[model samples]
Target: MKKLYILFLFACTFGFAQNPGDIVITEIMNDPVSVSDTFGEYFEIYNQTASPIDIVGWTLKDDGTDTYVIVSGGESGTGTTIVPAGGYLVLGRSDDTMVNGGASVDYSYGDSGHTLGNGADEIVLLNTSMVEIARVNYDGGVTFPDTPGASISLDPSSLNENDNDNGANWCLSTTPYGDGDLGTPGAANNACAPTCQTTLGASDTVCDSSNPGATDDTYSVTLDFSGAATGETFVVSTTPSGFTIGGDDPTSTASGTITVSGVTEGTDITITVSNTGDGGLCDLTRDITSPVCIPINSVDLELIGIIDFTVLSGGSDGKAIHLRATADIADLSIYGIGVANNGGGTDGQEYTFPAIAVSNGDHILLARSLTAMEAFLTTPGYNLFDVYLEDSSEPSQNGDDAIELFKNGEVVETFGDIDCRPSSDGTTVTCPNYQFYEDAWAYKDNGTWTYGAAQCTDHDTGNVPSTWTTFDTPCVYPFVAALSTQEFSEGELSIFPNPVSNGNLTIKSKFDGEMKVKIYDIMGRQVLTAEMKTESLDVSSLRPGLYLLNVSLNNLSSTRKLIIE
Candidate 1:
C-alpha cells in the first residue's frame, strides 16, 4: 500500500509541472521614454492556454539578478495568484501608480534587487519547482530594440512561447492605452505590417547658363524608392517659380534622376516626389539652397585699389577696398592680412561672396560704410556694383599694414609686408613699415602700386605717385568710365522715385540691347542681379537702405544711387 501511494504522488507532481508554452512573456517596457526606470519599468505575461493557471508559486526573474515570487493577494501575500486564460499579468515597479502607461499593476516588484536594463537583458518565468516556462534574451537596440515610452509587444498572431523568444516576432506597441502613450499592456496586440520607405539622393550643382563665363546656377536631384510595388509611377516637382523639370511628368521606375533646371541662385529650393498612380506611400520631399558658382582660378579676380581713409567719420564708409573681376565668378572670398596693433602676432579678417553672379569687368567695392563710401565718391549719383562690409581691421592703414586677397583659401594677391622695416629710430630702433597720412590712398595702376596725393584726384596707372604725392586733403578716386565706346547715353538709364517707399523700384534704360543690372547695398553686398531682356527691373525685395545700381550693356556700364524706404 505505501509503494502504491508513492507512485500516485509522483504522477501528481509530474502532472502539476507547467508546460513551457502555458504562459508566455508577451510584452516588456524595459525602456520608458523620459520616465524613471524605477517607476516605469515593467514586463507582461499572457496566459496562452485554454484554462486558468494557478501561479501561486511562479517566479519572475531578470538576468539572475532579480527574482519576484508570485503571491496570493497584496504585497504580504493573501490569496492564490490566478491568471485567467487569454488574460495578462503585469509585473512592474510599485513606486508609482501611473507607470507603464497607467496599466493595472498585477504584482509589485519594486523591492526586487534587479532592474530592467535599457540596453539588453534576460527575462525568465519559472514554475514553483524552478522549471523554466519561458525566457527572452533581449538586446536593447539589437534583437529587442528599445521603444521609449512604448512597450515591446509580441505579435498576437504568433502566440506560441517559442515565437515570443524571437525578437523578430515582436514589435513596438501602437495602441494608445494610458496617458497618451503607446502600448497595449493589458489588451490585445496591434496588427503589424511591412513598411515601405522612400528617400532623396544627393543634389548636384550646375551652372545655370552654359555660356563661357556663366556664374548663375541650378541643381539636379534624384529620388529613390524602396519596397515599392512593381511598375510604380512617381511625379517629381519643385517649389517656387525658378525651377523646371527636364523630363516627362511621370516616371515608372524605383529610382530616377530628376533634372531640376532654372533654379535661382541663393534661393531655397524644395523637390518633392509622389506616387502618381495610386497616390500611396511613396511620397517625400527635400530642400536645398542653390549654391554659388566658385571661380576656378585666382586670375579671374583682381584686387584693384584701397581707400585707406575717408573724410567721413565713423562707420564702414571710413575705409574700403576695391576689386574687379575679369570673368563671371561666384562665391569669391577675400582675406585681410596685418600685424596685430595689440602687440601680438599677425591678424587676419575674411569675407565671402554670396550667390549673386559677378559678370566680367564688374567692379565691386568693399567698404566700411556704403553710405559714406558713396558720399565720398568723386562721381556723384553713380552706383557701385557691390558693397561688402569688412569686419576685419579697417582697410585704413598707415602704409605699414598689408592686405591680402584670397580665392578658395589660396593667396591671389598681397599688398605690403608686416616684416618690412621701412622706418627707423634715430639711434638703433627700427619699425617694420612706414606710416601714411590719414587722407592718403593707394591703388594698383597698370600692375603697379600708386599712392594718391593728400587731396582726392583720379590718376592713371603708374607707381610714380608713391614718392610724388604729399599729404593735403582727403584723397578720393572717382568711378572711371568704361573704356569701350558703347557707354550708355547720359540720363538714358535711370530708376524712378530715387527714394522708394514701397519695396518696388523700377529700372528704365534708354539704350536697350541686352542689359545686365545689379544692385549693391552700402556694405558692398550685392542685393540683386538679373539679365534684363525687358525694361522693368524689380527692386522691391531690397531692404530700406542706401544702394548703388550698376547697369551694363556690352562693354559699357553706368551707375546710380538708389534708396529703398
Candidate 2:
C-alpha cells in the first residue's frame, strides 16, 4: 500500500500531447536539506494546457548519466499522475510521505537509475516519440539561486518553455511545502523577479569635503546605481588604488548611492561593480576624472581700516570697514561684523556677509550706503577700495565706537577697544589711547590704526595723529592707497632687529633726513619718544615686552607692533 504509485497508471487514461505549452518544468529541489537525496530530491512541472497533461510514458532524463521512466507509479495510491490544466506534478526519489519529507510524490524515479545533480545539470523531458519536449540547464547556482533547503522555482506568471530557459527567470522558492522545507512543489509557484545591475555612473558634482567648515579638501567620488538583487551583495572597486569605496557595501537596499571616500583629487578613476556573483552577465564600469578639490575658506581676514564720516548731506551713511583677505575665502556668509557703540561691550554680530569669494590682499569696503560711499569716493584723493558691498547693519558705527569682526558667530578680531572710553576734561589733551573720532576717518597702516586730521567736536585739543591733507568741513574724508599690499610689506617700509636685543634697531624707509619715533606700552602710555636722525634708533632704555612703535616721516606715519626681548 505504501508503494502504490502504480495506481496512477491504472486510473489515468490521457495520452501524449503535442502543444509546446502542454508541460513546463516549474521548480526543482535537488539540494533539499530536509531529507536525504535518495528520498527528498525532487523537481516540479506545471501543466500549461486547459486540459490535463499526462506523462504516461514520457522519459525524464538528464544530459549526462541520469535517466528515469515515468511508468506505473510505485507509491501514489491517489492515481494523480495526470497533471490537470494549471496544476503541478512532483516527481521524486521516494514515494512514502514519511521518507519523502511530506511531499505528495506522484511517481518515484528509481533512486538507482536517476537523481538530480546538486551542481551544473540539465533536465530533459521526452514525449512518447523520444522527441525533446522541454529542457532546463541550471548551472549549479552560479546563475540561479543556490540557497540550501530552498528549491529554485520558475516565475509562475510567465510559466512557459522559453521563459524557463534563462536562470534569471527563476528564484529561490520561499513557500514551504508540507515537509517544512522551502518549495512550492505540487502547487503554483510564488513569484520571482530577478534583480540585476542595470546602470552606474556619477550623478552629482564633486564637493570639497563631506564636512562643513572643513577646508582640508577631502576628495570623494559618489555614484548611483539601480538593479542590484536584494539578497545578493555587490562589490565596488576603483582602478586607481587608495580609496574606501562603497560605504557599507550598499547591502541596505536594492538600489541607492555608494560613495568612495579617501580618494585623491586629479586621479583618473575606473569604477567597476561586480553585480552578479561571478560578474558573468550584469556588471558596471565607468571612467571619470577626479576633479581638483575646491576648498571653502573659513573666516580668515585682517581688519585693515574703518571710516565714520561722510560729507554727503543727512550724514546717516558712509560708515564702513576696510578688510583684507588672508586666504582665498570661498564663502563670506560665515563672516559677520558688529559695532560696539560708545563704551559698551560687544553688541553681537549684526551684519553677515553674502556668498562671495575674496582672494588674498583683496581689499573690501562693506559700507552702510552704496550711494553715499560712491559720492564720497569721488573726493580727489580716494582710491584703494577693491570690492564694495553695501548693507545697513552692525558696521554703521558713529565716530566714537568699536568694530568687531565675527566668524561663525564668534568674534575673531576687534578694532578700537570696546570697553575703553575717551576722557577729556576740557583742559588736558584728550586721552592718549582714545578710540574716539569726530567728523573724520581712520586707516590701518602696519597693522595698527591712526586717525586723519579732523575737528574733535567733543574735545577742544583732540590730540590725535593726522595724515589726510584734505578734509571737507562737515565730513571731508580722504583715502590714499598709493601702494599695493606687496609694495607696502616689501618696498615701502622695513623694520629689522625689532626685538632690540642689543641697543639699536634698524628702520628701512624711503626717507632718511629726519623721523619722529613714538613707542607706547600695551596700556597705551607713551613709554619712549625720540627723533631718528638716521635709520637706527636706540631702545635699550625701555623694558622687554610688547609695544606699539609709531614712526612718522614728513607727516606720513606707520604704526607697527614691536616686541622687545
List model 1 lDDT by residue over 1-565, tens digit each.
Answer: 9999999865553345378878888888887664567777777778877666777767877776677786666352432256667777777775245554565567666655657878788888789989998788888867564777778888888778878777767888887655655777667777655333455566666755433345555445443333333345666677875557764333454454556766655677777777745655566777766665544343667777666543434433456777777766654543332333322234554555544666665677776566555544533322445545544445544433456665555666666544443332313324333333234466776677666554343223343233221121334353333211244677776767778886666667665588888887654557799998776667778777767777788767766677788
What is the lDDT for 161 in model 2? 92
Best by lDDT: 2
Give every collision pair in model 2.
Answer: 3-74, 4-75, 4-76, 5-73, 5-74, 5-75, 5-76, 6-73, 472-476
**Best model number under TM-score:** 1
lDDT of each: 0.61, 0.69
Residues 327-443 of candidate 2 have per-residue lDDT tens digits of 677887888888887758888998888998977546688887766666555432334455788875647777667788888787888787677555323123343444456556677
Candidate 1: which stretches are off by over 4 Å? 1-25, 28-42, 46-88, 94-105, 111-152, 158-187, 193-216, 222-281, 287-289, 292-302, 306-402, 407-441, 446-565
Q: What lDDT would candidate 2 get against the real structure?
A: 0.69
